[model samples]
Target: MRATYPRQDPPRGGVRSWWGKAWQRAVEEAAYSEAELKGGRTAARRGEVGGISVDAGALLAAVREGDDAWTVQVDVPVLDASGRRSLVEVVAAESGRVAALLAGELPHDLVEHAEELGVELLPYGGELAATCTCPHYLAPCPHAIAVLVQTGWLVDVDPLVLFAVRGLDREALLSALHARTADLEEPPARVADLVDDLEIAADAVLRARHLLELLESDAEVPDSLL
Candidate 1:
């Protein structure tokens, strides 16, 4: 799903919000000067970024500065199976965390545990590969920086954006959660108990075979029993 930049003020969450903090970290990690980063933030806040398109491992945007237009591409790292599993396990471990994430809020503790497990739910500069058509030597021109910042805004409105950039789309994440839920709802069969049942079934089969042999010698088999 595509998340547009919000025209209104963000949900009063700011840097305290999970995505905001993530975005801040990414911007801070950039080699850009403070003035340049501030300009990019201004552009993002002013809604100068548009035509946003998000797919697995990338976010595309059209950034407008005055009459000049620039194309920005932000490469998000997709999580590997182990990383995805770690995230699911962390989130599914707590019902409240699941609920909060479903409501478009990133639970702080959940993110912390995920980070501990080596799963990055947020965009670190190392994971945020960026490029722009603008002539600036910086990897992220101001326009691209704007889009990256707006990405955080998108994450705020939709926590799934975090997964989208991290490599799991919203559907895949939800599907994983469903699988986790199904696993939780369904009790696992005990190997020892199943083996015992199989043994009992085998014994019953033997007893039936012996009885059939005896019946065949003593009397006609009953069709009703068959």
Candidate 2:
């Protein structure tokens, strides 16, 4: 399912977050050409890339060069189900991670915890699948690279952009965490609940006995009864 589009404002801070820097470095190292990387970063800085449509495993944007425009998309592999579950569990394990996420920040420790669980929350250089609609010979044309660079800005403002690319949206992530909170806040099992559970077990046992009685013959006792 497509996640809600993340709203991004330009970073008010003078420098990108450490996580954002990591993302940029990963992208830069993966790119085959430094000229393409420079061109892309330049376009992003000049606001040449329009609004990006962020999705699970995909990022879509239009990069404009003067009168020319081309559609660019970067495909990121979605995290597998096991990794996503581990991510949720790790985030829920720490109260600080939960609080940081709720406060619109991605905690440094959260990423580290994810790494411990064998989940790479950020895409490395080899993982980027960039393509462009423009007829360019470059494997990752300047337009596509521009979109990728523009995405780094979004990461700077809100690091959850990484999650969206990995098949989970920010709202869904928060909702999952909220469910964990609810579970923690849930009242402990009461005496009455335990009694009810015992009664259910008793009923199941009686039904099993009745079924065995019907199936057994007069000459033969079931091994369970013996």
* Model 1 segments more than 4 A misplaced: 1-16, 184-226
lDDT of 2 by residue, 44-157 (tens): 777788888989899988878899888888889998888888888887687556445534467888888899989999888888888988887875777777777768877765
Which segments of model 2 are wrong by more than 4 Å?
Answer: 1-14, 181-185, 188-226
Q: Model 2: how far is 24 from its true place, Å?
A: 0.6
Question: Candidate 1 lDDT (Cα, whole model)?
Answer: 0.70
Candidate 1 structure quality by residue, lDDT tens digits, 5-44: 3333333446456567767787768636777688888887
Find the number of clashing residue pairs for candidate 2.
Answer: 0
Give me the displacement of residue 197 in model 2, in angstroms. 34
| Deviation from native of the Cα of residue 93 in model 1, angstroms | 1.3
